[model samples]
Target: MAFNYRRIIVKIGSNVITQANGLPDLQRLEKLVDQIAAIKKSGTEVILVSSGAVASGRSLITVSDKNDSVATRQLLASIGQVKLINTYSHLFEQFSILCSQVLVTKEDFRDRLHYLNMKNCLEILLQHQVVPVINENDVVSVTELMFTDNDELAGLIASMLNAQALIILTNVNGIYNGDTKLPGSAIIKEVTAAGIDFSSFVSTGRSQFGRGGMITKSTIAQKTAKLGIAVHIANGTADNILLDVLAGNVTHTRFVPNKKASGKKKWIAHSENAATGAVQVNEGAKLVLTSTKASSLLPVGVVAILAEFKKGDIVKIIDERNKLIGLGLAEYSSDKAREWAGQKNQRPLVHYDYLYLQG
Candidate 1:
């Protein structure tokens, strides 16, 4: 069987790693490690985004009065992360495959500099033939900085690395047309640009030790696919599921990419931080930015300023109709733009390299 991708991000949910008693399953971990090592031996690059820290931590603790509170979970994560990485390291080492652990919080991606640093680090690891095992830093993450789940994190990583595909290993075979437990519910073979409605099959029950359900996975699939990365949702518990899915020999749900955005454009468009201010422009300015390959936002076209911002800060560019046309890094601050607007000799408000036109 022909493998579909050269580089891939494989995300294993907590349910796939935890047993009925809410403990990490050693056998399951071994199987996953073996499969990943096998793929690496075949000369394919793999990044693993895994979840199971809190669950594994819970198993280590004998007794606790705290009842699954955030603080308690954080404490558990602090204890479990070591165990998780140790297990992964030892298992992969058996096959002479080296692995590194990377723990990230949402704040890491909020800043462009830090985000780029992380991307560079992962790339370096791949160059050394080391698989980077990533997990969220649950110990320090607050509500706002916390990713909804590993599924969202996986999507972000895939987009960051420009991976060809993101494979989300879950408990179910794939998304179902109807209720998964219903007699006639069938698996969705493929999901093209036109998204499928699997709302009926979505469940509110969180995994035995995980936070998200199929709903979260579906949201991740759709979001990542928009960035031109194919997303596959398949059963992680099934024997040889990872190999079969990668080899295109399994019945799994695949979300195809729509209009693929360039890597730089995707980064600019999806930056975690919002624009610092707004630049109101006439229709002509909007047309020039959207249609022409202009290198700068000419000052003569700027009509108004809605807020104050500094140079180098991201800002929204709006048309005369008040519709947001795109986001760009301001060449001039709001105060400067105000002074320069309508001036015949003033420089551009934002350079083309710093701008991203929205679709």
Candidate 2:
């Protein structure tokens, strides 16, 4: 079978791999692993972002109700992670394939250096024909530092690795236009634009075993698609779901990709929350930046420095209305930006190549 993507990131949602009781389904996991192994053998590189460590832990030991939710989660992750990885290892071994466990937190992508380091490590593993089974470091990731879910993490990984496509496996077939349980509701097959809103039709309820619901998935899908990466949301519970989606013969929602972006811009695109400083630009500057012309953020365009940030730090570009325009890597510190604000003939605060404009 011919696959469209040479490299792909597959994210298996908790609900797709767990039973209603929130326990790991070994049979389902084995079946998925077999499919992944076959794809790997076909010379397609795969990176799996899987959830279910907590669910796996839930079956291993009973935690006291006295512990807060966060503590209980940490405990579950710490214990369940071992079982999760081991299960993957054992299943992959049946097909004579090697899979590596890669645990990461949000801090790993906080800066360019850290981001590149992670990219290098994963690339090396792929080069050696080793599949990387990546998961969020749930033990250390707490509260604000945690990823929205594995879907968000998968998007970041796809962007970082410049994967050709991202396949998100969930319990449902795809994103529906109305209530999923409704008889007349139908799945939206293709998402070709970013401005399309599904708020009126998409369900907001979180998954039984995952933190994020369809809303979060749609948001991440749009963001990933904007960066020139095809995204597929399909049902994992169905037989041959992965292979069928790859073959384009399945009922799933696909987000078409835009023009490809550079590596720096791709990183900047997902670093909205990582920005440490902000710059409020004049109306003229905002207009020029948002226009069709290729432009850099210059000191003359910057009307005010709203926050402190060092050189190389991610900074937010804002308009006079205090609305975010985009994110970019700062060429100079905020102190330097302040000294040169509204001054002409100064170095650009952010180069066009490092800037990422949001839709």
Candidate 1, which segments miss by more than 4 Å at Cα? 196-205, 273-308, 315-328, 336-359
lDDT of 1 at 140: 96
* Candidate models: Cα lDDT each: 0.84, 0.93
TM-score for all predictions? Answer: 0.84, 0.98
**Candidate 2: tens digits of C-alpha lDDT, residues 66-155:** 999999999999999999999999999988889999999999989999999999999999999888999999999998998899999999
Kindly give the stretch of ten consecutive residues in candidate 2 with the minimal lDDT sum.
Answer: 1-10
Residue pairs with backbone atoms closer than 3 Å in model 2 (clashes):
none
lDDT digits (tens) for residues 1-359 of candidate 1: 44568899999999999998888988999999999988888878999999998877877885467566778878889999999999999999999989999999977776568779999999999999999999999999867778889998898899999998899998889887777677998888788877765576666666667778878888779868877899999999998988999888999888987777766655666553456688899877877888857556888899999878887777888888888888877877899899889777777888776677764
Q: Return the top candidate by lDDT.
A: 2
Clashing pairs in 1: none
Q: How much is 341 displaced in model 1, in angstroms?
A: 7.3
Q: Which stretches of candidate 2 lie over 4 Å from their true place?
A: 1-3
